[model samples]
Target: MKATRQLHDLGQSLWLDNITRTLLDDGTLARYIEEDSITGLTSNPSIFDAAISGGDAYDAGIHAKSLMGMQGEALFTELALEDLRRAADLFQPVFESTGHVDGWVSMEVSPLLAADTAGSIAAARHIHHKGRRDNLFVKIPGTPEGVPAIEEAIFLGIPINVTLLFSCAQYEAVSEAYMRGIERRLQAGLDPRVGSVASLFISRWDVASNKQLPDELHNKLGIAVGQQTYRAYRQMLASARWQKLADAGAMPQRLLWASTGTKDPDASDTLYISAFAAPETINTMPEKTLHAFADHGELHGVMDVDGGDADAVLARISAAGVDIDQLALTLQREGAEAFVKSWHHLLDGIAEKARQLAGKSDGAVLK
Candidate 1:
């Protein structure tokens, strides 16, 4: 069997961390679902920015929207929704078969809203409603401000993918926010089966710390952090609070391993993918990483529920002067800023494309 299927059979979800019109139009996304067991997908400003600027795939859409007097964020949102809705439909079968736990497609709110709680909440609602698809998750960062917005979006029954998390504490914070949202729903006599996922980034930790560590610990920090976070995730599901919600029909907000693609050329391409192989969790991979895994990946044994030697590993790293806690905060802040940068680039790319298309027609330019 292909390693992708083997991994899927082991109960870890394999989701493509990309979306582009060509993937959909050429049936590549559907092929991944049917052949590679990719049950879900995710997109952010960076992904969209690349898609919009990298090719002619989005030029026609940009031109049409531009002609209709749409530009900037508004135009981009519509274009994103178009792709997500189609991808959502392609995954509908997996969605139905798994009873809504497996198949999902995520669309992030404007990254500029990462620190604006009210704006995050409003954008999530608007995007979720605009997509008009049940399996679409509106992504919100797990920033201090975004925590409250996550709770609100969940309570409002909008599926959420909490992004930009870099630590176990951050994961727990968003998990609590999700449960509070469910508890509120139960209080108001609403359905408690809202879907959510706490996405903890993995590879970024290693990227940030590798240079400071000894060679022995080079690519190990990210895996250790993942192990620690997985332990917390298991404990959270076993907690009395979660059990009560489970009994009340609330779904456990799943723990997702994001940024699983290896960043270092010296490391194995599937390093993060093979390391984080546990049930009821997700590993979203870049397109190159996904294809690499399918080609030659091996399933290591499942992750340790007790976190293995994660604490010990973390201790050693801390002793090496890494200041793990402070670094987590820095990574989260930097991640949010990076997304905002991508968001601006996406809008600018759209406007530039619109101008190019307009000049081709009538010597006009988009504002």
Candidate 2:
């Protein structure tokens, strides 16, 4: 069996952390769903920026939208929704079969509003409503500012994929926000089964710590962090508070593994996917990583619920002078900033494309 099929059978959802108009129009996305066990998908500014700038797939759409008075973000959102709505429709079967527990595609709000809680909340709702798909999740970063937005969005029954989480503590904060939202809904006599996922980034940790670690710890930090966070997640699921909410028909916010693409050239390409294969969790990987895993991946077993040696590994990392908490905060901030840069690049690329399609050539090309 393909490794992706194995992982799916073991209860881990394998999601493609990418989306492009070409992938959809070319039937590649559909092929992946049929053959590769890809149950869900995710998209962000960086992915969209690459998709828009890398090819002419979106040119006709951009030209049409621009002609209709949409440019910049307005145009990008229209393009994105069209692609995501199609992906959502493709995954509708998995979604129904899983009882709404899997097969979700995520669309993030503008990263420019990362710190504006109110604005993030409004954007999330708007995007969710505009997409008009039941399985679409509007991604909101789990940054300090985004927590309230996440809670409010969930209370309003907007399915959310909480992105940009790093450590167990960050995941815990977002999980609490999800629960609070569900609790409020229950109190107000509303259904508490709002679907959500708390995405904890994996590979970036190793990328950030690679140069600082000794040979033994070179590519281990990310997995250790994942193990630690998964432990916390399992505990949370078993806790009395979650049990109470579950009894009230509130679905647990799943823990999604993001940034699973291998960044270190020396490491196994499928490192994150195989190591973090815990049931009831989602692993969203880039297309290259997904294909690599599907071709030759191996899953020895799911992650240890007790976290195995994660505590020991993290202790060694701390002894080596890396403050895990501080690093978590730094990574979150940097990730947000990186997305903001990508957002601008995407908008600039769209405008440049619109100009080119209209036979005007005055704006700077977005390279």
Error of 1 at 250 (Å): 0.8
Please give the lDDT score for candidate 2. 0.93
Candidate 1 stretches with Cα past 4 Å from truth are 363-367
Ten-residue region with minimum lDDT total, candidate 2: 358-367
For candidate 1, give the lDDT.
0.93
Q: Give one digit per residue, the lDDT tens place, for model 1 in 1-367.
A: 9999988999989999999999999989889988899999999999999998999999889989998999998999999999999999998998999889989999999888887999999999899889999999999999999999999999999999999999999998999899999999999999998899989999999999999999999988989999999999999999999999999888889999999999999999999999999999999999999999999999879999999999999999999989999999999999999998999888888888898898887754333
- Clash totals for all models, in order? 0, 0
**Alpha-carbon deviation at 60 in model 2, angstroms:** 0.7
TM-score of 1: 0.98
lDDT per model vs. reference: 0.93, 0.93
> Residue 153 error for model 2, in Å?
0.5
